[model samples]
Target: MMIRFSKMQGAGNDFVVIDAIGQAIDVEQVDWRQVADRHFGVGADQVLVVQRPQDPGNDFRYRIFNADGAEVEQCGNGARCFVRFVHEQGLSAKRKIAVETLAGLIEPELLDDGMVMVNMGRPDFHTRDLGFVDWQQARARGQADIDDGIERIQLASPAPEYLPSLELDLMSMGNPHAVLFLDAPPNDDLVEHLGPFICTHPIFPKQVNVGFAYLASPNQLQLRVFERGAGETLACGTGACAAAVLALARNKAREGLQVQARGGNLWVEWAGGQSPVMMTGPAHTVFEGLIVLPTR
Candidate 1:
């Protein structure tokens, strides 16, 4: 079978988007790991399968699979690319459309400047949802609040190369993330060295995306994220949203913040607590191609 696909990128977080809605493809039967392979298949941070919405009011159903073939709850960058993909393909005429995801309905809008704005939904700060033990103490003494917060936690490190009991600000932006605020500028070495430990830490039972964030200014921040299954990509949309919420909660950043990732910059705005985080970035189509799949 020849599967048609579109290669898209939002802030350098790329995806191989397949139009299952139009093609009538049974996406569940497809081997995503083989399709996401960089050397042997279409390379991407994740694979997006666009299908008709289950709900009558929604425009589409967005399904996400990481490079490792695990289906995740949500993806901000992919959401942007999703809207762009549908619009370019004439799937929907509306500039602003709602798409259903594992986390819930996410609305993404296509702006006049060719940028995509997504309402990433409200972030969850409660420790229970974030897989943390104590909500009150963890929030109060989060690493953002104390200098030696990393030493406060008694959790053992998952690896010997990493430090034990690293303090992190946990949150759920459709997906779980552990934000580690750093005093100095972040580097690739740090993300590569400490990211794996933090990502697989026993604290996060479902695992977590580890974000290394640095407050550059009141409204500008630098971030690098090690995604759950994709490793460290050039950009991570949900990571930006999670980082923005954490930065604002810790008073490190203001409402409108620019999150500079390794690939590009994304604008994240939050109106404090219980409000959806707005993320604005660009999505581009790299190319389109067809892949031949074996009949299993």
Candidate 2:
């Protein structure tokens, strides 16, 4: 069957948007590897499927799947693209609309210039759930020490980061992440080089998003994350949340700070030291087209 989709971007983080409303398409049927095939399929950093709201008092419901087809919660870049897609396609008339995601319900406000700002709920944390074994195992496998009250998982990797030298903050916002603070902005080559290394590290049972942060001030930060399935994306919502939390812990930045990602800038805020984290950013529509589903 031929399915119509919209190709959109938020700060360079691209996605394939689909409307499953009144359609019998089983979104889960598209496997991770298949959806990420650039030659045989619609290529994108992630895939977003629009559907009827699962909750009352919401404008719509949408789900995010990484290029590898792993369903995740809350994509900052994708969220921005989502609202723009809906507006462009005449799905909603309101500029401010409430939508539900795997992470939770969020309100996205569309700007006049076509940028989107979303109220990404908060950051989540769990040392164990982020898929790390105990401290000793991570130290041995990842070649790092787990001090400073930060819980971590050190999944094995073919070539891992210098764990002992780097400080990583672990968290989840419906997905898992590991954030590292760097002295300077890593070159694009360095980012591409180490991102996958940390993502596949032995300590993270579920390959984790690896974020490298450059702290500019107590109120400003620049970050780039190698998303688990998507590789080094322009921006990452969960990674931003984790970076904000980690920055606060190290006193590098305060809550309600500005974070610059590869895609663009995001405003991240934290209330309680260990409470939910907030992420805000933009979304844009690039074009719309049709894709024929490949038979399995």
Q: Runs in model 2 with CA error above 4 Å? A: 22-24, 31-35, 112-114, 129-136, 139-149, 152-164, 273-276
Worst-scoring 10-residue span by lDDT in model 2 = 155-164
Q: Could you give the C-alpha RMSD of every candidate to the true structure, in order shown? A: 3.9, 3.3
In order of appearance, the predictions have TM-scores of 0.90, 0.84
Stretches of candidate 1 off by over 4 Å are 130-165, 294-296
lDDT of 1: 0.84
- Measured by lDDT, the strongest candidate is 1
- Residue range 7-126, candidate 1, lDDT tens digits: 999989999999987786777777787788899888999999999899988889999999988899999999999999999988999999999999999999999998999998988775
Residues 103-129, candidate 2, lDDT per residue (tens digit)? 688777787765566776655555564
Model 2 accuracy (lDDT, Cα): 0.73
Error of 1 at 47 (Å): 0.2
lDDT of each: 0.84, 0.73
